[model samples]
Target chain A: MKLQHYIGGIEGLEPSSFEKKVFVQPWEERIFGIHVAMMGLSSHLEAVKSVPTKFNSFWTWGHLRQGAEGMNPFDYFKYRYYEKWLGGISGFFVESGYVTEEELSTKTEAYLVNLEAPLPSGGEPAIDAQIIEYLRVGDTPACDVEAQPKFKVGDTVTVRNPPPVDHCKLPGYLRTKKGVVDQVYEGTYNYYFPTGDGVGDPMPIYNVVFDSHDIWENITEPNTKIYVQIFEGYLEDPE
Target chain B: MTENVDRETYSAARVRALESLLIEKGIITGETVDKVIDFFEKDMGPFNGARIVAKAWVDPEFKERLLADTPSAIAELSFPRGMAGAEGENMAAVANTPEVHNLIVCTMCSCYPWPVLGLPPYWFKDPTFRARAIREPRKVLKEFGLDIDESKEVKVWDTSAQIRWFVLPERPDGTEGWTEEQLAAIVTPESMQGAAKVAVPA
Candidate 1:
């Protein structure tokens, strides 16, 4: 059976009426804060080539998502977003050789042994405030190459239905679906794959307009339109 | 409840382990982590978005520029110099009008305008919101307490790392003479996300 596009389907699940909140628990806040810190460190490590693992931003993100994918459905749904991040980063650290599996497992055991012990503190800072500021302000340069866009605005093109194993920008739901190109972003941008070998080829991005009815079966609102950004390589002439 | 506590403990311990390893490896230090957290908490957030929306509401020219070129117009204001960097690059602003309601989502992942809107709320990143927002946006908006007219069109922008999107919600009425500060006060992060409407003070 095709996966239901709407999360709870039409009749079975009731929409949540509970008050929407930013963070449900204190640990969530820590997760969010630490995720930021991890991202900053990852970027710094990538910059300095300090770690043996030479992954880019997208690779790190893909590894994080893959980690969540490994979890059981119950735990996956129950764990907060930052928890998923923690899991992903832990798995990534192990896979990248930055931290050993024994280290991760043993450290948790040590912490559990003395739960009341004061948290580890006091270390020479690697990224100073100025470095953090510079990193925060840094921008990735758009790919500068001369290339003709295969599809123009209003061209009907379908997303290639390739099962990409590594990091990719194309979403699963959009695969093999046809949409009209709404806007063409001329410049090619460098996107890294999960394989830390090197930066992948750059490609221009486009905004494709897909009708809600075309994408989903039970169309509640036919007038609704979903605009998704598609990379040039992902598009193909519709069969 | 025990399971929840165990998971949190495990997660926290993992972070601690990772931090220690990075520090030991000379990759990063605890102070670096604290500094990064401080930057997000103290330096950047939705306040910048509120300021931009308020400025647009008061200045017609700026509003036109914002809708036309978001990054340049945003740079016009006294926001940080890195407005075009990180999650802020290729930023696009879609205004909500009487005929069209704009909603932002990333069906693939949570791609939000971090520089302007700050960290996204948990629900914004939830799988339910990501899927249903495209399938049944009107129903989703209603859940957020926004009931749109049947005559209006709903446009959902599936944002990505390539182009980050934020909604320019229609300014609430009855605040014609209000200062930018007052207008900014009324704008919530949800309003900018188009999940909830901006309301006038009673």
Candidate 2:
């Protein structure tokens, strides 16, 4: 599908002081088309995870993206080629009901404000402000309030080897690096719905530092150091 | 004691009164105002570090020091103090190349290297660009109307609120013997982000 169709929905929102026109080129159009398609797939994934049906196309698409090694014709059809079309269908399912702008705004505001609300113990609470915002408008989660870190200044620990496959907050560049805990900063408990994980306060992640040479690999000077700070999810118990 | 109490109460009351007046006057627009105030409250508001990046690009020793010890490099500049809304001794800057340009996007949220590159542009904050930029950076750059030579590498930095990065563009051409001031003239925020390159216009 063409990229213009993705942003076609945003045209209706009353332009506010914050609104401005952003043009797209062909390459960008394709990228956005992919992104919007992903959003639709992610929403469907949530739906399928919560309530399974022969309408399990979202899970099938996610599995294909994961490249889950298994027998799968339906997976390829739902995710590999027709994902965007299906995603657009997912978008329609979401925007089906009548919801007022004020209600939407109120919901959006709540999501943005309490972005890091924690997950309930044992039970995954399906409904959240961020989810509501994501379903109604394609807005993703932003700065969270509850990401409080646990490691202390000067704690020598190693980053976790590989992040959890399903969902993660860690970036790939920082995986498996070692460093001193420079400082402990607070993080909020905002749930990133796409991956379906919760970031919160009580167990805030510290910014662990790794030397520059270790991170970049190409540094010629052994003494040449590039320090990188990482969150807790990226770290594991240093052996 | 009574006078002191009265003064305190009066100041508090005055602040509340002004807040109400602003809201009544539409001077304070809902959560947007709260966000602005919150931003100010958090020391790492956008523009603070940008000034430092602008200054460092000119100073060779500062650049050296920044590369050496980023926090200390930033401390060399005054604005490094009180960096709110982030973790660690937060200081980082990424250099751009002639062949490839760099731009930052907070796909998940507006996670920026505030100390180096100040506040994000309106477009940077837009969900449209933010979401698509990560999934397809080259495509996004093409949309910005940049036609990078295929041979030239295009590296896109996705700062996922885990760590912040700043892009330092290749110094503009025709600067064979130009001073830092002249060099800095073309090193705009856009140039640093790789969306645009630094070229001394003829």
Candidate 3:
């Protein structure tokens, strides 16, 4: 399927194609609210595990996408974005052994037991608002590891159209496209996989300027430029 | 909005079930959820962005520092600790000038400057906004009720994990000699996202 570009006034693309409404159903708001809660919960869980020191949305997103894949195609498309998060968290809990398939199937028993128990103290919870806020704001993955930038500002490069990998920051639309490095951030940046088993090596990040004509086949205004953040691994010396 | 409705099949039910299970397991408590919600609702949000923008408008040196080094400049002001986390890390500020108007979008995913702008709006995360913002920013801006001049160039910045971006909207003409508080009153979350211009009070 051709991914819809946010570009305005392109030929053959209608404004109606945009799903402009913020939310179509009331359930969507509930899903969003719960998703925010889950984010805090998941980060706390990840911290308690202490294997991965950082919170990675890509990790959660991978699981979320995988869970959606299990659903019927129609349901997958029909469900709102946060609904996918809700389902994905369910699947993740099971997969990570936080809960069991039988437990999920028999939700009532677990629900009743928890409801009956006296509420725990705020201090007892594995993660609190302060930690959540810290996780939200601290420890950017940019590292001080010594590394030379492969490309410099103004260098012409092409996005490496490598075969699809399990997880990536590189957008599919920009693959094999040419752009100029508008700005170069001089530091090795580490991007951890959501799975937390491994991380992409620290590398310089660049702001690459791709002309509108290059991004879209049809050019309305050639002067328009799109600035995208790209990692060194995603760029190749254009042949 | 009906408070009591049958919603067993809704995702919220599933979330409740999950929350209960976590509580039962002694992993988290009801307070944990409340704290997270309260932080976003009360402490951290676009209000912070408004304050920063107001400061920049009144203080020229701070504005230069904000545009040059956003995080450090932000630290100069007393916001609650934790400005350098996942959402706020590597933040860069783009100024909206008469010559240029900036629009921020994340085509890959919803990567936003949460410390200043708080969470992204629902439409900001939509696939349509991500895909079209780069291609047709002018039209998208117009849809948001912002009509940029035809002569001015619109620069669309696609934010990501590496760098988060927020816009410093131009101060309205009538706000001269106004206190920072008065200037801040006019800043809106949409203006920080470059979706709408800062409202000029009558």
Candidate 4:
């Protein structure tokens, strides 16, 4: 099992920081913007109206999370949040043949010498506009399918134990546990792409609530309830 | 926090290089990164969430609609566009009452309500927070200086699916007659995340 997947209920780790800032490092903001821009310009985004940009690859949060989830468990915890983003995203550009490692490293060396070295300028303003447009008019995954929900509100369902994949939406701790459906969401939702386990197609998502004692037993706090939005694919009739 | 000094410089340079190369190759513009950052500051941020919560506090009808259908209720507001944008297509708000407190966490990756909340804070993204908060939310909240009495039920909402969840922190006392702007000013991001409570200035 990937340590990344089973982060919930793991013991002994202390709270890192109450650091309130969204971007801890100034450089983190740049990488975050780049990721968003990539998502906006992603070739697979059906809702976007398209822009004149050469970023032809299919990129999304699924692709980025797969990179981070694929890292060594120790390495995953060693790096800061955006630090992982920098490594994963830069690697994507390289692996996709958008840029070469040699070129990136050489530019790195040049910038190290002069941190304020001016970035090479000039590209279409349409590219930036499209990226912002994606932010404004998001590509929602809600589909036109009539609800064919298997479980209704108050149904006690067990989370299916699908074979673990690199990235999964099922919180590892919730697997095999029984939860009561608190709310059957209004309509169907679709993942951007199918995560090998069971998610990705148009299906109902449920707000399932579990007693903390049910999942963690005596170790959990008293009078605690955990509510999670889970895909219908990852849930089943309790065995 | 003894991070490698050269590694920090390397990362800074590396990201700059990535941006520069992307611009050079016509993948994104030189203005792309800056404009994206500006969007968060101007269009989407904690400021928007504060406003939503503030309006909810004053208008029980709007608050009722918000708790029932998050996107539809939020759409009624006059905030900048994109209330239902990226990471916010399906949103929900769980209200904090004296008996039940709500905390939002993504145990796997930091899944957050970006349009309403702008971005996940550094604390929310930390692995330790993710790991511990799911199982021991009361303890985690206590560490953050909010001693949630054992009598109060703590509901930790994990945003693992399409739905992005945020807390509708109870309006603080002595602010009954205040305007929406005054109420919004007291609502901090942490409070909206259920880590703390909105307090009137001491």
Largest DockQ belongs to which candidate? 4
Give the Cα-based TM-score of candidate 3 against the true structure: 0.82
* Local accuracy of candidate 1 as per-residue lDDT tens digits, A1-239: 11222222233334633235556554455445545544544553345344322223333344555465555656766756677777776676688787799887777677655544444555544345434644466445367776677888989998776544434456666777889999998687766342222224676788999887777766557578888887777777444
Using TM-score as the measure, name the better of candidate 1 and candidate 3: 1
State fnat for each of the candidate structures: 0.40, 0.03, 0.33, 0.91
Candidate 2: which stretches are off by over 4 Å?
A1-230, A234-239, B1-55, B78-89, B98-100, B150-152, B176-179
**What does candidate 1's lDDT look like per residue over B1-202, in tens digits?**
2245576576666566666666566555546566665666666678889999999999989999999899899988987666775577678898998899998887666778878887788778776677677778898888878998768889889875478899999998899999999999999888898899999978
Native interface contacts retained, candidate 2: 0.03
Worst 10 residues of 4 chain A by lDDT: A43-52
Q: How far out, in Å, is residue A134 in model 4?
A: 0.3
Q: Please give the CA lDDT of all the candidate structures.
A: 0.69, 0.43, 0.67, 0.89
* Cα lDDT for residue B91, candidate 2: 42
Error of 2 at A192 (Å): 14
| Order of the predicted models by TM-score, top scorer first | 4, 1, 3, 2
**Model 4 segments beyond 4 Å from truth?**
A47-50, A237-239, B1-5
Whose lDDT is higher: candidate 2's or candidate 3's?
3
Model 2 chain A lowest lDDT segment of ten: A1-10
User: What TM-score would candidate 1 get against the native?
Assistant: 0.86
Candidate 2 CA-lDDT value: 0.43
- Residue B95 lDDT, candidate 1, scale 0-100: 95
- Judged by DockQ cut-offs, is candidate 3 incorrect, acceptable, medium or high? acceptable
Residue range B48-116, candidate 4, lDDT tens digits: 999999999999999999998888999998978888888888788989998999999998888888888
Candidate 3 lDDT, A138-168, residue by residue in tens: 5466887978788888999898766534445
Q: Give the per-residue lDDT of model 3 (tens digit) for B144-172.
A: 77887758877788764488899999998
Instruction: Report the TM-score for the A-chain of model 1.
Output: 0.73
